[model samples]
Target: MRLVRGALRAWRDSFDCGGRSVAMWFPGHMAKGLRQMKGKLQKVDCLVEVHDARIPFSGRNPVFQEALGVRPHLLLLNKMDLADLKEKSRILEQLKQEGLKNVIFTDCEREENIKEVVPLITELVSSNQRYQRAENVEYCIMVIGVPNVGKSSLINALRRLHLKKGKASQVGGEPGITKAVLTKIQVSERPVMYLIDTPGVLSPRIGSVETGLKLALCGTIRDYLVGEDVMADYLLYNLNKHQLFKYVERYGLDAPCDDIESVLKRVALKLGKTRKVKVLTGTGDVNVIAPDYNAAGYEFVRTFRKGELGKVMLD
Candidate 1:
């Protein structure tokens, strides 16, 4: 983690979208999932909105607030292990000002802070008179979030903690792993609680190109949709801005670099990520070996996601 102290070169103040559209990334399935979730609001007792802790401010689908704001809402910022939450109090304060009073940081894979989820939901639901279904003793809460924010992992964690059961929802690293709203899966036996798991959905239009890039970096949006080269460049700019120089040692670089091309070239050569390319010569057509920039970009993004480069707050 060596830091180069000198006159630093200027990085990109803002990213250009290059006339790229985010509409293509918002598929038809996400729209259908939103509709289905809205239709199930009558039976829902609470709304558990999950999101990546690294991106707490950006990439949340505003449609959830507009359509499902009637119920008691709790925001679960998952993947705390990968986020740098030194300013957690400030983040919470900002969220509270935005009308989100309930927020919890959790890591579902390690089951960290898993016990607090049910109790918090119980308190919120009991305090609200709207959910007073006198005839029913069971609690039905709907879990919603954008794609690839560990919504399914949270459900499985609760089930394992309370019921000693296996997974009921499919888990994956990519976005849109769960395609549709699933049936209510019972997670607790004491208060008779059942959770409805919904597929991850994104807004039809993102707030801006920067927000979209943040979403892509956090795996909310697919890498191919945003282009790996562009995402890698943004990631480099962010790491340099935050002074997270761990990538330098991890990739065997002597000092911090401001250029993505040089960084990717070194990464490709070190990892042996190369491909054969056809070349035109005076002698005849020839094939030459060249560094695979795409492969290097993919690896760079992967390392950041896995926390190898160090924890960061991308918001």
Candidate 2:
């Protein structure tokens, strides 16, 4: 009942604010979601799948393909500013091999990039419609991606183009900010165009069901949780598989003969460990006086961002 009321209120508010009639279909299950929108899917004609340029594979919602089955989709890779340039080109090539021709690299924050989007979308929509403007034909395009990839910001920018009301919320954070179901924004003087902004989806790793669900919801193991010593252990274990040891040298961390415990002890010394070995190991309820745990954590993540841990995709 609450969801229904919220949807109605949103619809009414959007309608009053120069928006054409719009309805949102909340399809929680991928299969059911696709089926519910099948009728509207025929009218959609064109679809736009937005993904974070950093982790394109990770940012994608698998259900998008199911919903947009057999329909034309424009893959907009946004947030290039935060991504590794080398990976972008590699992923783009991979997607091309998958038979996706309509892919555009964009940083939607820029005016030039925003300008390019509408035209590209317009052209795609026109092509899908065979250059014919059918009566009462409503053009619909859905924007989907992982959390904190700037979908709201993109919608807000698009709203600026149309000069509409009902502002899209400005989400500020590292990632995973937007939580609403779907937001429908409309253009004033068009064929009643509709833009659907769905909730951001976190990607799941290939693992046990519980682990996958946790990754998909909270995210894939935040570095801050395990502290630097433990984080370094995980990174070393993973990167050593590919013979990447520059990470330790980069952070000035001692690479003590590939012994995880030995390296942890070295890290503790660098961090000004005041606690005794018994305390550190919790042998006698001794307080582990690691004063620089936070600093160590930052350094570890910094090294990772610098690619010292090799080409690791934390999806």
Model 1, C-alpha of 90: deviation from truth (Å): 0.8
Error of 1 at 156 (Å): 0.1
Q: Best by lDDT, which number? A: 1
Please provide, for model 1 over 79-193, each residue's C-alpha lDDT reduced to its tens digit, 9 standing for 90 to 100: 9999999999999999999999999999999999989999999889999988656644899999999999999999999999999999999999999999999999999987889
Candidate 2 regions exceeding 4 Å error are 1-43, 87-89, 110-112, 129-132, 135-138, 161-167, 170-176, 187-193, 202-288, 291-315
Give stretches of model 1 more than 4 Å off.
1-13, 16-20, 133-136, 283-287
TM-score of 2: 0.58
Per-structure clash totals for the candidates: 0, 0
Cα deviation in Å at residue 64, candidate 1?
0.9
Clashing pairs in 1: none
For each candidate in turn, the TM-score is 0.93, 0.58
